[model samples]
Target: MSSSMSVNPLWLFKVFPFLRWWPMVNGTATRADLLAGLTGAIIVLPQGVAFATIAGLPPEYGLYTAMVPAIIAALFGSSWHLVSGPTTAISIVVFGALSPFAEPGSAHYITLALTLTLLTGLFQFTMGIARLGTVVNFISHTVVIGFTAGAAILIASSQIKNFFGLSLPRGATFAQTMWAFFQQFDHINLHVMSVGLVTLLTGILVKRYTPRIPYMIAAMLVGSIYALILNQSLGDAVTGIRLLGALPSHLPPLSLPELDPHALSQIAPSALAVAMLGLTEAVSIARAVAVRAEQRIDGNQEFVGQGLSNMVGSFFSAYASSGSFNRSGLNYEAGARTPLAAVFASLFLGIILLLVAPLAAYLPIASMAAILFLVAYGLIDFHHIFAIIKASKRETAVLLVTFFSTLLVELEFAIYLGVLLSLIFYLMRTSRPNVISVVPDPRASHRPLVHAPDLPYCPQVQMLRIDGSLFFGAVNHVEQRLLELEQEHPQQKIIIINGRSINFLDIAGGEALVQEAKRRRRQGGDLYLYGIKPAVMEILQRGGFLEEIGPDHVFETRDEVIRHVFSVLDRDICMGCQQRIFHECKALPSPGGKPS
Candidate 1:
């Protein structure tokens, strides 16, 4: 590492896109990339269709999203595991934002969707260029947990109509669904139910018995087979199960999004919200995999990659897209070598979809729903949820608040609430630093064990420990506590602070310490610091507080000052003290200038 730093090769951010990772490429990596890419292509098939429908777009759009955007994102993104495509979270968010603007499954709706996608991409690209990846840092872990749980609920709710073969209206809120379910109890579709049950069971069995085979595909196969058998037996017209129909075999059609000022204005805010959500999801997933892979994720580069991918995807008839957790997890499990895996997956998927798109027309909607239910179930992190609930009251509160708020409030706003709450709670906790007065363990027969700070102090010197960063947020609390210590005990004049735990000190904090030192000196007392760190001392020195605090009063060892300070103590108090805390004081003559 060099002491001086220079700007990285900025041109690499454009050309070849993979130039940043080209140095890591080798022979063993190629094999790993191939396996991961194959797994990703197989897995993305069902997910693409499911996500596109969720976004209120034609099924082809989802496949389109998985093609060009994925390859571009992989080559440009910082992480090897992050596979970009249409995801459940992004799909649901798009549906929520655009459904109110135009009727779903209409030309007007499609136009608005494309416009929104363009705007969202532009916003994300702008944020990336601005290097504002730190924006996600404000969203605490609790918020993420809570938001995911709520999203899980929404996912299950959205698929409930298909799961039970009912005719409840699409896009119903949780409360609305419950009410609608009760009202529509008589309109249950039995053919849809049979296919759904078979699909659900097949998924479960495949997972338990043949874990290597992707359960969603296995379930869809079983469901489709059952539909075919039923169609033949019932003469096709009697059954109610609807199929996806065939997809057009071609490149994602190039098209321009609506350029109207009113159209862009209408969806701009919602687009911004989608952009933030997409970036957060992508970065978070990348970071998680990076930790496990023993790799470092470049957040700024990730932003740029995601932005470019979405922008390119929008023109190719793809809707809003982001990092798919399922694809990324599968990639990691399959031993991905590099970002090339994502590029390959998209390429393979394009070829596979063309061959098998017609087979999807035989697959029932109920089967698709059953598959999505499994997807929804997998999104929830139950073990972590339980741990958070048990570990900390503040974290638990944040989780519950975020989880519930996500359902009732707007998606973007709920994240803000959780972040704000976490910050407020954090500040409240750090404001009060624990100041403890300690002594050497008297009960230890062999060596000195560091004792609790509440132990009685020496008659000659008061020893206290400051256990937190001294900053503006903590100034008043620390000052008040220190002043209270003096007021409570008038006899405790000489003060020694064990400054080992003071990790940081700011200007306001240094000034506060200086002021406190002057007040103590004026009252016929001196303040001393032990084990002063070079870093903390530098702050005091630079701020001119070291002169006021008196450099002579600082000590490296506990016994040095206490031995000399004992000579100046009152003899009556020294003789009366039963606690022989310090060996040095006990070894020396009594304070009255007489031998012990």
Candidate 2:
């Protein structure tokens, strides 16, 4: 190959990320991926339909989402094992956002969902282009756990009517749902209840005993069989059992989302919420699986992949989708070798959809509800919830607040509230940096500074260490502490700050230090700093604060700062004092005006 042809442009990899891993595709890798893809395809059949029910979309739309979006996300994203499809959380959020505006599963609602997906995709794509992937870190893990648990409960509550064959209104709140169920206790349909219970119990048992089998498919089959027998022995009208109806068996057809200005404006807020939540879920899952697979994950790339998936999927009769934790985990465990596995999975899902779409007519609504109940149960991370409660009261509070907000408020607003509370808690913690007095340990060979309150301090000098960044938010608290120290020890006018722990120094912090230096100078004392980082020193210098504080006032070594401060101390006070905390104190003149 010529030099021009041999040298591939770096931008190509950005546009086509799969090229990076394409070289790993050999016979062995392809075979492994095919097997993994087959496994994933089998698992997604029931899950796709279930997630669609949660999203208030038709069953086939879930399979459509699992098809086009899965392929697109796998081809563009950074993870090799992460399978992007309809997820429990995203589905719930979609339903919650659109149910109030239009009837669930209606044409208008589907259009609204498609539009929302497009807007969310645009937002995600913009963020990826801006390289704002790190922004997801602000949504704490506790917040996600809490929000997911709350959404799970909502999912289960939404299905209560189908599970018990009650005539409850759709989109009822948790409290309202419970109240309605209680009022209709006497009219419960035992036939539907029996099918749901059988499904739920079968799922739990299969998952516990036959770990290799897909529990959802197993449970669904058992429930369907039981329902069929009941309807055969009795009659459909007599038993009052309802079926999910047949699904369309074809490729995802092209569709256009409504682009009216009013529709766009109405859906903007919910779109933003879904965008953030979806990105967080996708990136977090990718990183998690990457850890086990020993692969590197690029968050920005993952964002781009998800953005493209949803944007393209919007045109394919698919609703919003995100990373599926169960599917991704299963993909990895089934020995997926490359992103091709996800692509294959999507292809296989399409093929399976074509073959089995009519069979959905045999599936009972009660059985589907039973599967959803299991899905909701699995969404709660009980271990992490308990760990958060036991490890930190602050985290526990965040978890509880997020949990309650998700239950009490609108779903989108609940996400915002949880994020806002997390940011507030973070600011509160960082605003008050730890300012503690420290002294050198005499017994140590190098006399390293230690936080020992009981150790005697030099009567002429006070030393303090700050254990956080010096930002604008922290300046006031540090300044007040400095003033308090000065008031408490009037004789200790020469204050030395151990600045090793201060990693960042903002302009306001620099100004505060300058003002403190001037104040000390006016009082016949001085301020000194040692072990400051180079970056912080650069800030001090660029702002001219270092010049105001005097370049000589800063030192790189503790011994130099101590020696310089001691040389300028009031010798008269040292002569009368007996606290010889510093080695230089032995050189001070005695009361008779002679060298000791």
- Best prediction by TM-score: 2
lDDT comparing candidate 1 with the true structure: 0.82
Please write out the lDDT profile of model 2 over residues 365-416, one tens digit for every residue: 9999999999999999999999999999989988998888888788999999
lDDT of 1 at 27: 82
Candidate 2, residue 126: the lDDT equals 89
Candidate 1 wrong stretches, greater than 4 Å = 1-17, 26-28, 111-135, 235-237, 258-273, 440-456, 483-490, 530-587, 591-596
At residue 501, give the lDDT of candidate 2.
93
lDDT of 1 by residue, 496-548 (tens): 78888898889989999888888888988878887778899999899889988
Instruction: Give the residue spans of candidate 2 off by over 4 A.
Output: 1-9, 576-579, 586-596
Clashing pairs in 2: none
Decoy 1 TM-score against native: 0.87
**TM-score per candidate, chains pooled:** 0.87, 0.96
Error of 1 at 563 (Å): 7.5
Output the lDDT of residue 451, model 1. Answer: 49
